[model samples]
Every structure is written in C-alpha cells, then in structure tokens.
Target: MTNTDVGITDDEGSTMTLGEGRTPLIPSTHDENLYYKHEGLNPSGSFKDRGTALTVSKALEEGIEKLHVCSSGNAALSLAVYTRRAGLECVCHVPEQTSESKKQLMEALGATLVEYDGVYEDIFHELREKDLDGWNVTPGVSNTSLEAYERIAAEILAQVVPEQVIVPCGNGTNLAGIWRGFEKHGESPAMVGVQMKGAAPIKKALEEEKSHAVVEDPGESLAEGIIASESFNCAEATDAITASDGRLEVITETELEAGLRELVREGILPEPTSAAVKPVADRYDGVTVAVVTGSGLKNYTELRELC
Candidate 1:
C-alpha cells in the first residue's frame, strides 16, 4: 500500500504531507537476521510523526483551530511540526526538566511551550481541567495517535516477518498500536517492550504476569523519551502483550549507552530511548526487528557532550 493509503486525511483531502511513514528496515551488522526499523528518518525526526500527522489531520477536518499536548519531547516536536504545517496553533506542555534541544525545537516550529513545574502527569491533570479550544493530541489519550502507529506494523510485515518485534515503551502506545496492527493483518509476532530500569511500570507488570499496571516513581535515565511514572494506556498495552505472549525488558543506563554507541558505529544513530531495544534484540535467537523510534539529532546536544 502507498504511504498516503496508510494515513488519515481531511475532508478537503489534506494530510500532514511531510512524508511520515515507510521507513527502511535495515539489517543489523551484528546479526544479519536482526533488523532495525528506522523510524528516526521520519520527516520530523521521530516515530511520533506518524501519530501527529494523523492527529493534526483530524483536527483540521474537525475545524479545530488549536491543539495541545503534554509531552517529554518527541511527541511535542512532532505535534508542533504538523500543527504548524496545517495552520493550527499548537501548545506543548512540557516538564521543567525536558531537554533543552527539544524545547528549542518545539518553539522553533512555532509551538507555545508551557513549562510545567512537575512531571508529565501533573501537566495532564492541569490540561484536563482547562478548557482548551482544540484537540488534545496526547499519545495514549488521543484515539487517533495509536491508530497511526499501526502503519509501522503494517510496513514491517510488508518488508519482513520477524519472529519477534521490540520497541521502547513510554505510555505503551506504540506497543499497543503495533500489536493491534499485527492482529489486523492476522500476524502475531512476539512483542517485547523495553524501558529503563527505574521507571518501568509496564516491565514490572509484565514480569508479574499482571493484567493491570502499577504506577511508580520515574527515575533518571539517558533514555528520557521512555521514562514514565504511569503509562496513559497501560491497560491496553498489557492486554496486547498478554495476548501476544509477549514480555517486557528493562535496560540499565550503561546498557543503553553502549547500545546507542553500537548503533551509531553501525551508521544507525538513534536516540538513547530507541537504543534500549538493542540489548533485548541481541538475546533473541530467531529473526528479530527492533524499532528505533527517534533520531539522534533530537538529542544532538547531549550526544555531542557524550562524544
């Protein structure tokens, strides 16, 4: 199917038009049977582009003049880009500790940045109280967001059928989206969700074989993109993982750093969050695909400091 065929469009026949999907599935140099779905190559430099593209399109179709989202980074950037392109006002509520690079990029794209004093959950609560004039494009909270990520699974199945699929988990939207997409296509690959050790609510739930998720305190990690105290769509994610007989993996800071370095050395420069899937993929025996969710450019300042 064509790229446009995988996306939602407005009644006026308009979409984000930034070429969001159809990322390359490149075989890994470490293991030929292992492949990397390079979602970092998306127009806005992250997999969040897929969801934002569709979400913004719906906003335009509904005649919503403004859009808002509470994000750590990637989602905000993606939303800012698409909303700006579609001539809608975008407001991004971000944590005070959000990356400078991401905050700058959001503002550069003309999004009004609102720095929240607390974590993302706090922002979510605040947003819920305020009557925003437009749609809220929060990842799991927004219906259109996860549906857009289904295209990733469709694209992956079209390219190659892997024994397993691994991806970094924040609010678990991507994990749920991929699993649902595979189900739609009558394919069920073992889905693995990876998260940083300290803030791994979904991982803990998966290990206990629990159908529900427990909220925990998020900790510090280089993989800032996947750190979350509570996933907005944890129930859906748990259901998907359980249905697919899937599991969750937690990576340490050291492991994530090493993985990022290895990917960059292999000419695949992904954000630290995206690199978290590598160690898990390395342990899998059969053909495996690791979804690298964002570009290293998103963390250029921090990466440069590391180098």
Candidate 2:
C-alpha cells in the first residue's frame, strides 16, 4: 500500500503526496526470519518524511504559510522538503552539533536553519518562548506527526507478523506511534526501543519504572539522532513498551559502529542511529523486525571516515 492510503487528509480533502510510506521489509541475511524495515528509502531519506508529509498537508489545508520545528537533523530536513512542496516557509532550530550535511540539505531545501548552542530540548524551549506563529512540526511535540508514524507499524504487520518490533528511540514518538498502530489491529507485538549507551533516557525510565522520563545529560555518541535528554512522548512510549511486554536496550558507540559495518556487509547501508537496534536483535529468538530509520548518506562524511 502507498503512503496516501495511510496518511491523513485535511478538512479540504487534500492529502500530501511524497511516496513516504510502504518501505521495503527485507529479510536479514544474519537470520532467516529476522527482517529490516528500510525506512531510509523514503523520499527525504528518513522516517521523518512520514510525519512531515501529514503535518505539511494539514498546514496547507489550514493556510498556514510558515512552519517551525526543532530537530537534530532528519526531522528538519523532512520538514524543509515537505514545507517547500506545500509552498510554505520552513524554519528550523537545530543543535549546534548537528551535522554539516544535514544543515546543508535543510538550507538547500529553502529552510531557514538556526543553529542553537544547546541540545534539542533547549532549542525546543527557546522556540516555545519565541511563540512562533506557525505550525510546529516537531514529531513528538506535535500530535499530528504521531499519526504518520503509526502507519509504519501497520505496514509492518501487513508485510509480516513479527514477534518483536525494534526501533531507535529519540523523542519516543516513533516507538509510541508504532504501538498505537498495532493497537488498531488488536495486536501487541513486543516493542523494543534502542538508544545509545550514554544517552538513553527511555532506557533509564524503563529500568527505573518512572512515570516520566528522568532527565540526565545525554553524553556524546555517533548515534546523534537518538540522543535526547528528554523525550516529549516519554510517558506514552514507556506505557506502550510496558503494555507490549517490551524492554529498552542500549548499545555503546563501538557496538553501533560494528552494527553499521554488519549492515554494510549485508549490503544494507544505514545511518548509525538506525543500526543501534542491531545489537538487541540477537537477544530475541522469534521473528524480529528492526526499523532502520535513516540513510547513511546523510552521514556520509562521518561514515566514510569511520570506514
């Protein structure tokens, strides 16, 4: 099925078109039953395209001429592309450490990129203070964006009934959205959320059984996409994991690098963040599907250096 079949249409009955969904589910060579959901194949080269498409369409329908977002990289790029497609102005506030490649792509897409001196949460708070008169397209911050991610779970179930769904967690919206999607089908597959070892808010919250995420300094990691001190949808994501009998896992930078190399050996190029889920798959015995969230091309310079 196509993205239009799963995406939201506005009150005026106009749906965004980007061919953002229905990514390939290829069986992993490492295991006969294990599969990889290649979300990197999206038009914008990341899973964020799904949510951005819907948000931009809704903005168009409402005549919202400008859209604002705070992102690490992929979300900003996705927003820039969709907003440009919808003839709306896009502004992005990104962390200072955001990759140059991502920043260039966002600017190339005609988005105004504002580099911030702090983390994503800090940028988010600053943007709130500014009270930008536009639709905020940040994934977890905006409820509409979550709807786009639910389609990933639905598409997975349509392809195969896996025992577990593994995903890289940042703001936790994607994990929560996948659970919501499975709920629609009355299926509760085990949801596995992966994060970098030093910067894992969701994992810490799950381990501590906290109602809310326990804020901590997310140390550095190559998997910058999944590094978040606070996840906007942490509570919902924790609830989804608990409901599905799911668990959170953390992988070190070395493990992430190894996972990336493994993917390359298997002829699947993926961003380092996307490979974070690989270490957990071996721990599961049944059919498992790991969601590879973005393309390595976005981090081509870094990945090339690592190789």
Candidate 3:
C-alpha cells in the first residue's frame, strides 16, 4: 500500500513498535482482482490504535493531565493502552453490553471503566453534560482519528492503486479520514461506507438525502464499537459519500455473520465492526480495498464458533 513513513510513527524517539501500519493490501484468494487492508494487524488489536495514539499524544502535548471518553469497546481499549503509555489518567464510559474481553483490557490498562445503561451516544452526551474537572474529553470521533486513517489510506495508495475503498462506518471518522487523506494527496478513490442494517444512520441519511441524529435500539451486536445510532458528523459523512461517487451499504445480521465467517476462512479474524466491510467488498467488482478494521481476537470465540 502507498504510505508515508511520517504518519505511522508515534512521533520521533518512540520505540513502541507494535508493528502498527504498513499492513498488507492482500489480493484475496477467492478473487485475485480484489485487495484487503488487514488492519486487524494494528497494535491494541484494532485499527482504532492509529487514532487513539495520536489523540492521546495530542492530549498529552496540550498538557491535559487526565482524559475521559465514551466508547463501545475498541476505542476504549485503544485509548486505555495509549493513555497508559502516555502516563495520563483515563476514565472511559462504555456501553454495559460491551464484550468481557474488551472490558478486561480496559481495566488491565488502568482505565476506570464506567458502564452506562443507555446507548453509546447517550454516554457521550452524559459525559459532555457532566463536569469532568478539566479532564480532556476525547470526543467519541475526533479529527485526530482521521489523521490515523489518513496513514492507512496513504499506505493503501502506495501498495496498490485501487479504484475503490470500503470501510465499516460508526461515527464515520474512518470514512472521513480516508476521504480527506486521499483528497489531500490529490487522489479520489470510490469510498464505500458500511453499517449494520438496522443500525445504519449513514445509509439512511444517504437514502433520505438529509442527515439527522438517530437513537439506537437497546439490543446489541458483535460490532459493539460501531453501535452508534447518532453520528457527530452526519452531514459530513453524507457529503463524503455523495462526493466520492460512493454509497452507504447496510448489511443485515445474516450478511454480517457470513462476512465474519469469510474473513476467518481466509485466516483473518475480524471483529463485528470489521465484518461490516465485507459485503461492500463482494458488491464491487474491481481492485477494491476493504479495511478489516479490527482483530477477530476481540471476538475470537464467537468467530471460531461461527467458522
């Protein structure tokens, strides 16, 4: 994949090489013409590491002593690891329904985990309303994550020039980053955003041609991190999709399950969030790149059973 060395490194003099970034843009065995960006290889076992590291670092740079964030799973884990490294206190409000392993990882990294009863977005709103005592609140989907995704896009462009790029949509930060990264470099790749069927606000917005916040249902899926019903950047997401000549594709539970299974068969274990990108890959018939956003290890048992 096309990449910039400067974007991937965690600043200079940092020797923490979890071998993050520069992941393979592999040609699928099933279809030689297709490519996959195996982002599951990132440190902290998810693509969110890219953004979390940068966000945490920037927060530290700004002299923020403590941090708080609301997440479904992946982002919390990413922040936990990064904040621990940066010697910053972290308090994460996560959905009560998030995975056990994810919760364990958060605590293991020394983050104070507060489980909330309502939706993920509700927790974000709650955090926003409360007095954090000057704790740097990591916006659930910050622009810094886009910088991380930019590194991903840069690498993809370098490795193999693709006609299309697909990513799982949650807060739409990943899509926004990829769109902006390529655009900054004077490149335009057809960008497809995927969401779980009934949970897809981005797809709905595109279909309706207007963007609005959505309230998520109580039930949960394996793609816990992307269980967002409301997008902080709904209009921007809509604009990116329209501008890219791309569309949002929402996959049903059955379709998502199948997609998860396919990744395992190929020796890639994708978490629920990453599984959303699969159908988009299947739909497009070209040198398409689908970002496998997180490790199957996050949902290892579930994936193994399904496989």
Candidate 4:
C-alpha cells in the first residue's frame, strides 16, 4: 500500500509523499506472536519522514518557503529531504556529534547545517538565543507531526491489531500519537515505552512519581535517536502512558547490546535505541508490535563497534 492509502490528504485531496508511509509490518523471525513495524524503511531511513511529509505538505500549502528545525539526527535528515522535495530552504541545527552518515545525507539533501557543541536541548537553547522564528519542524513539538505520527497506529491497525504497541520513547510523541490514532479508530492497545538506561528521563520521572526531573548523571549510548538528556514533552508523554495503561522501561547498555544482536539475528537491524523494546516484547503476552524507529544504517559505524 502507498502512503496515500493511509496518510493525511492535502487541500487538493492528495497526500504529498516521498514514499513515506505504508511501511511493511513484518513478522518476527523468532517470536511467533511478535511483529516489527519497520519504519526505518521510510525514505529518510527513520519514522521522522512520516511527520515531515505531512507537516511540510501543510506548510507548503500555507506558502511556507523556509523551515527551521533542531534535531538529534533522524528528524533533521527527514526534514532536509521533505523541504528539498518541496523546493524550500531548510536550516537544521544539530549536535556536532551526530552520526556522520545522517549529517552528510542532510547536507546532500540541500539543508544548510549548523553544528552545535552539545545535545538536542543545548542546540535548541542556542536556536532560541538567535531570536529566529520560522516553521519549526521538529518531530515532537507540533500538531501536524502528531497527526502524521497517528498514521503509524492507523496503518498498524490495518495490518494487525495487536494487544500492545511498543515504541522507543524519547519525548513520547510517537507513543502518544499512536494512542490517539487508536482512539480515533475507537480501539486502544497497551502502549509500552522503552528508553536506554542513561537517556531515560521519562522512565526515571515515572519511577519517582514526579512530574519532571532530570537525570543527574546521564550515561552515553549509541542509541542517540532516543537519547534526550531531559524530555521536553513529559506531561504529554506521561499523560498518554497513564491514559493507555501503558508502562515504561529503562534498558541497560548490556540489554541494548544484547537486544541488538538478537534483533540482527532475527533479520532486523534497528538502531541501538529502537532495539530497546526487544527484550520486553519477547516476554510480553499476547500479540505485540514493536515499532523499530530507525535503521541501524543511521549509525552503522558506531553500531558495528558496539556489536
């Protein structure tokens, strides 16, 4: 199925796409009841394309000629591709340490790049300092992107209505969006959010029963996609998790490494962070679908070293 079969349509009644949606839902190689929604197959090699396609389409229709975004890697790359396709200028500010593979491709897609010395929050802070305002296409911050992300759940329902959906949670928009999507269809599934140990502020906050808190000493992992030092959408994320009767998990470096090996053996090479759900999904009862957020190709070099 094409993205148009399952995505938001424009005012012209056509979904602007670069083959961004209708990703295949593949059965797992090991667990019979578990499946993988391989979003890495998206044009930008991450689920971020789903958001970019819709948001950029809406922006283009509104005569938006330029876009601004702050991303870890995948989001910037996806924005770069969509904006270029729309013939709009894109400026992306990303951490200096982003994977070279992702950064190089963003530039090749005609996005002007400004590298910063820290993580997403730091870069975003500096962007705020510049007093520059335009269309911000970051994945978790806007309504259109959330609407686009809801399509993932819609497609999953069409493919297989599992008892639960597992997602790698950074800011929790994808999890929340999917829950909302299922709600729009009048169905709800158990939502599960997983994060790498060091970067899981959401998990920590939930565990502590607090509204918002930062990890005092964050650790490093190759799963940079889901590694937000602190979450910006904590309330939205927690609300979704709470409303859906979903639970949170924090996986270790050992678990991330082992999960990567297990998933690779199962014929899925997810980025290290996206594999955070494998161990949990392996033990969950009933049908479960794990959303593999991005491809290992986004950081093949670092992943190979980790493996």
Candidate 5:
C-alpha cells in the first residue's frame, strides 16, 4: 500500500515511482484459482483513488481550490477524500437515496454534501447551470477520471496477466482508462464489462449496435454505483470493448447478491458494486481478476443485512 511496494519499468528503461498500486490479488474460495483484485483495500476504500489521486494532484498543480462533483457514491467519496487531502474544498452533489455511510464518509473527509431529491444526472444538469467562478467540476468520466483509471489495467497486467479483465461498468471511465492503460503498456488483456441486468446500458448498446441512453430503472439493486440514467460515453466504452475483443454482459441482482455473500464468507468485504464482478467470473477460462471496487465499510449495515 506504499510507493515502494510495486514495480514499474518504462519503455525507455526509466521508471516512475509507483503509487499504492499493487493491491492483493487473492484467490477466490469458491472458484478454483480465480482471483479478486481487492480494490476495497485502496486508500480511498475504492478503486477511484488510483485516478482521483492523479486528478487531484493535477488540480493542485493547476492551483484550483474548490471543486464540485456528482455521484451515487464511490466516486464522490473518493474525490472528496482526495480533495481534502490536497487542501482543496469539494462540494459533492449526491442523490437523496445515497447511503448514509457514504454521506458520513464525505462529511468526515470535510467535503460538503448537497443532497438533491433526484438522480445524479439530474443533479449534474443542475450543476451545469450554475455559474462557477473558478471551481473545477470533476467531469465524471470524460475528464481526468478517465486517465486516472488507466492504472487499474496497469496493475492487472503486472499481477494477474489475465486473458480477460471483468469490471462493473458504470460511468465508463474505468473501462476506458483500463483499456488505454493496457494498450499503452503493450499489455492487451481482453476487457469484459459487467452491469446490472436492469441497468445494462453497455450491453444493450452492444446488442442493438447503436448508442442509446439508458432510462433509469425504478427497481433497485445493491449495485447502486453503476446506475446511470443516461450515459454520454456509452458508445466510446463499447468501442473500447469491441476493439479489445471483449464482450459486455448483464448480471441479475440475484447473482450479484450471491456474489456479495460469497465474498463476505471468504472474508473479502466488498460493496455491492464490487460484487457485480462475481457472475461474470466464470466466463474466462484462464486467469481472471474482478476489480472489487469498493469497501464494505462504505455500506456496512446494508451489505451486512444483505448477507
């Protein structure tokens, strides 16, 4: 969990110091030799830290102070913590239904939380209308987040060298970042994307061979982090998947919940979003690592009740 823990060798034979990049890739208790990249162990308790650190570091370099972002949970909390750490202020606009634990985490990190009575996209629309004097808005996936997430692919390439990388897709930044990282590092692993059955925008877009915005589902699942009413980069994410020769699939809530239980029984406490990687674990025959994207601590009570 420190800089000295992981190795990085550049193409020019030069090396940049590694961040807290190498997380434990432990074997799954249920499956034979399958492994899980325990992203819950990340500094921010989610894989978002890898990118948020890069983004906030850049923001600091740019002399930005106050920042704003909208999210259902993980990304907002991650950015909030990083911003606080960087001595900058962050205003997180979250949906009213966002977990209390996540809200508490944000508050404890010294970020202001603005709870709106609608979906994240709605809050995003509201934010767009606001006149910000100098505060930078974390452009969800299309901005620095995309570049930050690239590290996930780099870590996977070094550790597992899997035939395929399965991630729970939401904003598409993680998929795009990971894909670009693997491509840049000359490590081309097949990238499989997983989404909730009801909110499978990427899968629907692939099947229809057209980019269509996903309508919000009224029904709920534990994978709250991946529920976006509409996605701006769905096409781009799909393109990345197709280019990598990977497929995107939808896993039912029942399957994801079962995965959550399995993870807990194995002592890998993961958020519901993290658990979505479970159903798709069986697809790839070779080495496969599912990104456990958030800590159960972010939603301990709910995750425990589900168990």
Candidate 6:
C-alpha cells in the first residue's frame, strides 16, 4: 500500500498537516532481528504527533475554535503544535507542581498553559464537569487519539511484519490502537507493553487479571512520560493486551539507564521513557519492533544526569 493508503486520510480534505506518520522503521544495529520505529522524528518529537495530527483536523472540521488537554508534557507539546498549525486555540491543564520549564515549553509551542490544583486525575475530572467547549485532548478521552494511533500500526505493517510489536506504554491508548490496527488487517503479533516499575499499574493489573489497578504513591521513575495515578483507558488497554496474548514488562531505573545509553550509543537519542523497551525487546527472539516514543533532547535535564 502507498503511504496515503496506509495513513489516516485527511478525510474532509483538512489542511492541518505536519507530515506526521510515515516514520521510518530501521533495523536495530544492536540486534539483527530487532527494528526500531523512529517515532521521535515527528514534528513534535514524539508518537503523540500521529494522534494530534488527526485530532486537530477533526477540531477544524467541526469548526471548533478551542481545544484543551490534561498532560504532563508530550501530549501538550503535540497538541500545542498541531492546534497552532490548524489556527486553533489549545489550553493545557497541567499540574501545579509541574516544572516552570515544562509549562514554558507548552506556551512556547503556542498553547495556553493552565495550572490545576489537587490530584491530576481529579482536576481533569472536575474540568470534565464544566462541559467545556473544546475537545479534551487527553490520550484516551479523545476517540480521535485512539483511532489516530492505528495509523502507526499501518505504517509499521507497510514497512515490516514482525512477530511482535513492543510499545513504551503510558496510558495504553497507543497500545490499544496498535492491537485494533493489527486485528483489522488480520495480523496477530504478540504485543508487548513495557513500563517503568514504580508507576506500572497496567503491569500490576495484568498480573492480577483485573480490569485495572491504581498505583498508590508511585515511586520515582526515570520515565516521566508514563507516570500515572491510573491510566485513563485502563479497561480498554487491559482488554487489548489480554486479547493479543501480550504481557506487560516492568523496567527498573538501572535497566532504563543502560537502555538509554545503548540507544544513544547506537546513534538514536531517545527519551528515558522510550528507552524502557530495550530490555523487553532483548528478551524476544524473531523479528521484534520496538516503538521509540520520544526525543532525548526534550528531556535533556534528566538525560544529561542519566548519561
């Protein structure tokens, strides 16, 4: 299939575009059978671009003037760039304690940053009660986000057919979408979702065979992208993992550090969150493809320390 044939079409001829999707799938220098999906090369330097590209287009299609999201970082950055490109307004609701630099980056990307107090999830929940005018750009809350990530699987399939697809899973929306996409094409690859140890509620839930689990007082993690009190689409994500015969793997800080160094040495600088997949990918035989979720340049503060 052509790139257009596999990617999400600008259904109504929406103009919002950043050349999102069509990321290269390159074979890993470290492992002959392993390939890395260079998602960090996207305009916003993360996989969120695949989803944001579509979400912002939908907003334009509906004549929506504003959008809002609750994000710690990448999602907001993605939304900010896409929404700005689409001539729309985006407001990011971030934790009050979020770093000034992070908040400033969102603003720099053209998003209006709003600070929220109390539990991160609870604050968003309360905002939901407002019945806001714009779309909730949270990964799971947006149907477009889930549908958007399906395009990644399509892009990956067009490049190579691996025996397994590994994701550096955060809220699991991306993982759920990959399962949906592969299933749509009648391909069954063992999906592997990797997470940082402390904030791994999805891993815990899978072990318990439950719909979901909440991480109480999640420990400090090097992978800030995946930290969460509870994943927004836990049930859907859990169902996807179970149905695909996939299991969750948790990574500790030490392994995460090694993985970060390995990827960088191999000439790919990935954010710590994306590097969490290294150990998991190493364990699998056959053709395995791991999604490199974001750029280490954006997380230079932590990346510098880790290196």
TM-scores for all candidates: the values are 0.93, 0.94, 0.91, 0.91, 0.89, 0.92
Residues 27-146 of candidate 4: C-alpha lDDT, one tens digit per residue: 987778899999989998888888888888888788888888888888888888888888988998898988889889989888999998877877766665565557776654565666
Tens digits of per-residue lDDT, candidate 2, 1-307, equal 4434443333212287677887899999879979999999998999988888878888878889999999999999989888888788999889989989999999999999999888888888777777677877776668776777887877887667889999999988888988998888778899999987767788778878885675577877788889878777888889999999999888888888888888878888898889887878878989899999999999998778776
Instruction: Find the candidate with the highest TM-score and give its number.
Output: 2
Worst 10 residues of 2 by lDDT: 5-14
| Model 5, global lDDT | 0.76
Per lDDT, the best of the predicted structures is 2
Candidate 5 residue runs with Cα over 4 Å from true position? 1-19, 139-142, 216-218
Q: Model 3, 16-110: lDDT tens per residue? A: 33446667777787987678898888888888777776666667667887888888888788888887887888888887888888899899999
In candidate 1, list every pair of residues with a backbone clash.
none
Collision count of model 5: 0
Flag regions of model 4 displaced more than 4 Å: 1-15, 208-211
Each model's C-alpha lDDT?
A: 0.83, 0.84, 0.76, 0.80, 0.76, 0.81
Candidate no. 5 TM-score: 0.89
Model 1 residue runs over 4 Å out of place are 1-14, 207-212
**What's the lDDT for residue 108 in model 6?**
89
Worst 10 residues of 3 by lDDT: 8-17
Worst 10 residues of 1 by lDDT: 5-14
lDDT ranking, best first: 2, 1, 6, 4, 3, 5
Give the alpha carbon lDDT tens digit for every residue of 1-307 in model 6.
5656555454523357788777888889878999999899999888888788878877888889999888767888888888887789999988775545567778887888888775566655777777887777777677677776777788887877889989987788888988898888778888898877778889888878888788887755667777666777777788888888888888788888899988888888898889988888988999999999888878887767777
lDDT of 5 by residue, 125-179 (tens): 7787788654545455337667666766666656567778888888676787778
Instruction: Indicate whether candidate 1 or candidate 5 has the larger TM-score.
Output: 1
